[model samples]
Target: MFFRLNMKLFMFFLAWAFALLASSLASAATVEQIFKVQNRTIKRLCNERVIVTVNGLFPGPTINVHEGDTVIVHVFNEAPYNITIHWHGVFQLFSGWADGPEYVTQCPISSGNNYTYKFKVQNQEGTLWWHAHASVLRATVHGAFIIHPRSGQFPFPKPYKQIPIILGDWYNAGVEDMEKALAAGGRPELSSSFTINGLPGDIFSCSQKGQNSETFKMKVKQGKTYMLRMVNAVLELHLFVTLANHNFTVVAVDATYTDPYVTDVIVIAPGQTLDALFTANQPIGSYYMVASPYKSGGKMFDNITSRGIVVYDHQYAQYSSSHLVMPSLPSLNPMMPFLPPFNDTPTAHKFYSNITSLVGAPHWVPVPLEVDEHMFITVGLNLQRCDPATVTNDTCKGPMNHTLSPSMNNESFVLPKGRGYSMLEAFFENMSGVYTTDFPSKPPVMFDFTNPDIRFDLNLIFAPKSTKVKKLKFNSTVEIVFQNTAFIHTDNHAMHLHGFNFHVLAQGFGNFDPTSDEAKFNLVNPQIRNTIGVPVGGWAVIRFQANNPGVWFVHCHVEHHTHRGFNMAFEVENGPTLSTSLTPPPADLPKC
Candidate 1:
């Protein structure tokens, strides 16, 4: 009798499990679409929009999928330029084919072309995003992708509700216009403010006046908790985010759970995502959800550009006299996150250092030795001239290097030094700070930001320089240090690496001594990061395996600084381990 009862229970459990599996499969969402990124007239204003988006919207609709299910996204490009999509922070690790980034792993889809991205959803149940990866095309093409748990395992605290808060910056002048201006060596004007979900601050009023903004408003019940998945979609800005009248606890970042960090304000940089739990337990009221530039001493031009509003209840309108007071936040101080050592043992430390420093090793073989390299550069900021034109023109009229500028071979980076230059020649030959490939493997270099005893032009002012005929090889196992010279800007520079994440060895002020640094390097363990900040007037050492191919961008992560020409690219040639098994671009590849 007992055996019979056990058999019945086992059969029942199997049946229930099968039923659930069937239902989940049945509910799997499908997104079949062809989207175009183009300029269209919205309300008679020539607004740049992504038309023919999923179901015909500017931003393709949010894609909801369950983990362990297959996702098929068929994209067609009707736009003028080629575009590619990356499902950022998604756990499609083994499915590298569908993990997009044009020219990195696959080619972009050209205008009047189509491409299908298919992969299994093996990521943790969390908030994720999708954006275009073409030459900075994310400025217009992006949307949210929310993955639910197939097994009902929760990644965060279950709130009464949930919402995705995508943060993006808008340049109403149009992305193509910005790109054109930047390429032209002129300032690409920007919108006065950032937007929340593509909506500006005064949406209701703006709408009445036939205006459109990106700000999004949320209504909540008193005494309820809400899960906010805040995604930073801005290409370059690191934002300091906060909500008036309420504090939040950050539960996750980049889809990884963190020890709950409670704070009144949160700082999130580009390429970083945060999950915060907010409470609406206060008296029925309204408050502004605000985001501001995280850099310090930013010019005091005050305008409420980064904004959203949260209403506690319907009665908030009745309390017309009540003003939602903004909370006092800790002064923004950019500091490195405290982390555990990467290689604790001495042997492991030595091995790690070898991986970073050894040329021709599997780690470092990819970085190309220059066959015909142009200018190598060291970039930073400096003080400004009292005159506004000099300051803006980067003329440096005062005594010494006035503000942040790019330097080549210990000289400032300058552009178009030749006389009687033609437009075509300037486009290719007259770039500032041009250099040859003859840089030494380890030079005794010095950087003094506090005070300059020696004077140099802020920009290179000579003929274009190119690399020597010989190549300069670098070991992947070795560490590269960047020294920041003096600049008027008090803020530090963010170092971003391309192709691979690197271990940040250490950061300190003053010049770098190769022999001393090599001996003292912390190879045993270091913080692994994709972007790092080299403190003002200081130096930062980064270690990575040069494993990826093609040209990769390495630059100061500060958007504006980079816009001012403080960046460069590295070539990672295929290495021995790089297999001939590598695939070629698809037939629909776009030509830029």
Candidate 2:
């Protein structure tokens, strides 16, 4: 009977490929929204006080969606303080209790409660954002999520307007008087403008240019093709944009998709996100975009830059209300000028190792041949000795009195608090004294980590806070590297890893040998990023596939090096079924 009809046609095509993967996971679709944070009062560099906003907008709204869809949201806080949003590069696959990260996933919907959040945008698409993960109000919340790709599928081409930008970083001494001037010991000022989507634009004029303007603009259309997304929420600065004569083509980042990369200056850091595309075909009118501020390892910033206009499409030209259109730009170092020069660092390591992934497009992925864990961390800053209940004052003005901790492999993480819950509800109620799964994988003492004479190695510049982490083992893969140190300072950091999105695979500078940097790995088509920038003293690597389970949060998106600790956390462990685990919590999570 012809070998039993080809084994009954291979068991009817393996049950019709699992019934079309359970009918496209039962046609996704969930999308909800609510947010509402509160307290708004716009008035950028000309101050009007009272910040923290969400529905009253201030770079807030925008969730859009498609890629498999299932957003939700809700929020509500009403701002007095305590918050938590973070969807930054969302990979909350099994929805790590909607991965928001206050005390790392849940808790802090306080100051007038309300939570919600939900997840799933499965195979991601383009730009991603959403901020505040608690306190210092992420310098005025954030926004933009935008996925799109399900039935209008696109791996490129198809754009006549999308824009978004976001950027941010303004400190007219707001976030509660810069947290009461860093709790009285001093120093919390700098950044007074570098906005782009919340305007600081008309060159912060109070004169030399009659007030008004609020900037922002955009408008495009001279030959179609537009896109832009961007994001970087600049808190501790790390930008380097430019749109003047335009170029981009990039395609995506942070929200994945790549391999188009046509650059002409873009860099970005602080919790990244890019997109790009361009094509206004120059000549029709208005330009000026800028953004500047690329500091390498710190020494005071806010050397202001942030502009934005773009314009064009007024039907073709001639329209100036008050004379504008100033752009020019183009010197990659033609004797230095047009942007990127706050220690260029090889033009931010040639635009983050020239991106890659986008191979055959459409849900690409591939790059996890095998590797169950291989860390090596390191990162920057160190120096403890200043415990007046830690940095609140009382006889400790820092340096010599020490203070700024920040670490990674040499420890310093700490973020526990009382033990009522959070830390993913103390790993879902199994609560073992709040936290500690070890977290080291390397460096208890390694030296010359890019030693510029290792800041007079006081036995390697101090370290040790606690709440450690790094457990991970559920679908595994990992890899890390990171490195970057200079004994007492060094900079560039950015790191950021939450639910997930890795695979940078290489970034270099000084030490990271692995026997000649493992022949410069790029496991074919690298660059995936969920925030990277680690290269001031240099070293990057990355890799991923832990498969999202829970207790996420990994830090250094800067905000004073994540409040002087750089941070850490991973936990993972689950995936042996119940649909790759991590679900429980969310019966309205928030509770500490």
Candidate 3:
């Protein structure tokens, strides 16, 4: 059914492309400039001034192309730092060679250097973005890459007007300093503010420096429907997005147009994108447009960050004129509260065990993954060995639970030599837990995700007695279950695989019972997704065909979890690349 659905969608898109081609052709444009960035704010006192940017913008430019047009993006890195452009979610189906992530696919374009990424836009009309695929710099490097419909038709309903809203979180700390801290054995402080585009504070709050902080603003007509393309580009945190007094129909998710789900509130995680249409139905009044954190772990942190607000007006003008109002979005759900800091009573232990058991029940399974390979990946938290003087910041004490440090196995991977432009690029390449450079060619050294532990103890460490390596043949039919070792913050981890989407086999907590869970597997109507949650202390099994050529990535989707080393890489040798158009990076690319 999924194969048929994909085929039908593909054909429809092709027809739509023909229509678009008949209606209009795209004009190519070159946008370039130098941007000035500074980390002078008191909050980010540790950051340094950076002249790194393309066309004078952190995200370079929005490359607007048609479904069949070719895009040439030249990035010149003038910054003191190394940089590279990664077109995220741009399924390089036949052109996986240019699918950026620095080391994983291609080498990074260095500072004072330039590289051009050229690719044919073959995807159906949808929302996608680009960012620095190297190191932690993605924090500062990212922007929307909008593809208009080809001459024909669109996959989703066309709105009167489209707005590109890139949601991100900004830290005053310098990107280098923050990454250094995280790399040098310490937890980086939680961001004090989240921004829309790049604005903060209540939309109307005056900045401490006497000027108003920029708020993510939008203009809308009261009657016409508007399409908001929202991308949660922030590395960490899931967002619960809601419009004040107005409801929206989610037209698409992760760029895949869905059967529009209507709701006033929508939750999406990092690396996920949503396209929603709002009719601007609120009365002629100002209301907050908010995105708050979807609390998984952590104490009830009341911290609220508002992107901006929607101002509804009775204006019937051609263009709705309005200003953005940033507010502190309040949380509708509080975190599970914390009890006494110190506790070891029998009741407390029993209560904790019961709570763990209750939460450890059947982790919902999405559906069957129809692929050629099944691989088990491990995800857990581990302590970082760091110099006490340099690594131990006041924000966290001894690692493991206090800080949500996650890892795949105990070994936090380091990228092998000669993959990307710089060490930073190499570091980010390992974000997917699986580091190709260092990973063994055979099956994993440890396959514990299939274990039957109901709950992994927070402080307990699980080490395999045997270091003997096990190897699984590439492309073999397999079933690999992932068990979360609740060592880190005991929160569910969304396991995502790059290069292909898979069917959800089965999932549950309390030592996944092979017979029981398998019996419950929905051979039909099971949700097939590229990413699925491996419950904390629970297990999830995923199966897929390793048919696609090139190295693939599998890791936790929680951005922070990824940082702590829940990643690994798989190589799929010699498979037929899909018959699709793909382009190469352009020459004369500008330097950041």
Candidate 4:
């Protein structure tokens, strides 16, 4: 019956190379591609800045594959800095070597060097992506990874076309400069502009220190449905996206199929993706596709909308108009559609909580009934003492001569310096002293986590920095309650895992109560995702089966937070048999 409903789409795209995805269905394919990491002088927001990019494209080339195919990619680093590419949302079954994070899986592929990553995409089919895993490079070195199901396997409403919209930020300075500024324990510089498909749209002009960007446009025939796969690739900001007066039937998220959710606005955090289908049932003229920052507390910069135009083919116009209709969102910029206020928590919560996995569908994984390991991890910003007498003035930029650091379970994660081996390398070769498997399952102490008026506790303000990981048994069912705290201030945190997608059981504001929150868990059909944006000063719960044996990094997707020690890893022990264990590292793995 599912096949019967989606057969039209299956056959429609069987030969149609839509969205520039040139793939065949004779059999599962072996996709071979090369990514050249280099720097290019690009003019954006009235500045000619040298930005590091993959293949010189702001949003690099798309990697299109099917569900059961193998992917082999060679990344040659020509940029001046070290880099590593992460295949986000890919379940790296028996292929953890290719799960790239700077110090988790492998060291950085140094400049003038290259590394080969080989993996397979199995039992997953939808929108995923790849981006630079080190520092703020992901702002430019990212692209879409669309996985199409085999013929007759697609289960969704038939759409006439598919579109990939990559939402990002624009900065005048180079990414390294921004990293250096943030390393001083201060807030990073503000983004000059928000972008849609690499453009900040025409509303912004270089005369106002903004880029003269081309607005992305989607041309559609009247009455035809189109599927748009949207990715939030911003450095630290969450985005609120809407297509003027159109309604969307959201079908998938983070490569997982979901129950069709109809909504007008899309709230996407960093490192998240959404797929929605909309019909061109409106008038013949063009409409605005607007995106803006959905910031919930924190500093503000260039609070504006990144836009695109939705132009319908007027040849067969049913409701033709002489002039185009514009969206009615409240705008900071004149003649722009921008209604989503910076702190629209209710809308964001609705979009995040209402989504559920399309259970009983093909290739759906059921929620594990038994939990072998349960954890309560606190995610928050802490302060590290920076003395004027001992350290330079540059390092003491945080409040009260303290640098802004972050932590999980009150233990600030300090990744091992590239000292000849990554954590995975040390774990694989029995090299000791690099990392310890002692990450705690809960915070050391309890307090009013989200209270802003209470005097801050000195111990809570500073997490003892260390490199610690939680050890998990192979194939163990694990549950985690991620508590978001307000040490310095409360802000949304986008937590991402490396090798596996977890079931988002529940999310709420303030502290997490075990008894009451456990009752709210959606054990039947929770949304499965690799990344989740825990609410500001709130908490979220997730569960996953530690079936893959590897060293997987779990960190905040807001890259600057990861740099500030908001990260940890899981050392899942080897499975019982050879087939279930992690494969040996490749010969050309990068050496520190």
Encode model 1's per-residue lDDT on 252-353: one tens digit a residue: 555444445576666665655666898886655567787665443223221334567776655433223677544333222212222112212222222212
Error of 3 at 440 (Å): 8.2
Ranking by lDDT: 4, 2, 3, 1
How high a TM-score does candidate 3 get? 0.70
**Across residues 141-234, which tens digit of lDDT does each residue of candidate 3 receive?**
7788776665434444568888877777766556667666565444554665666765663533443224444655566656678988887776
Which model is ahead, 2 or 4, in terms of TM-score?
4
Best by TM-score: 4
**Which regions of candidate 4 fall more than 4 Å away from where they truly are?**
1-27, 207-213, 318-338, 390-392
The true-versus-predicted C-alpha distance at residue 6 of model 4, in Å, is: 26
Each model's backbone clash number: 46, 1, 58, 1
TM-scores for all predictions: 0.62, 0.32, 0.70, 0.91
Local error of candidate 4 at 3, Å?
A: 27
Q: Residue 338 lDDT in model 2?
A: 67
Candidate numbers sorted by TM-score from highest down: 4, 3, 1, 2
Please write out the lDDT profile of model 4 over residues 456-574, one tens digit for every residue: 56856887789999999999999999998888778889999888989999999988988898899999999989999999989999999999998999999887789889999999988
Candidate 3 lDDT score at position 320: 36
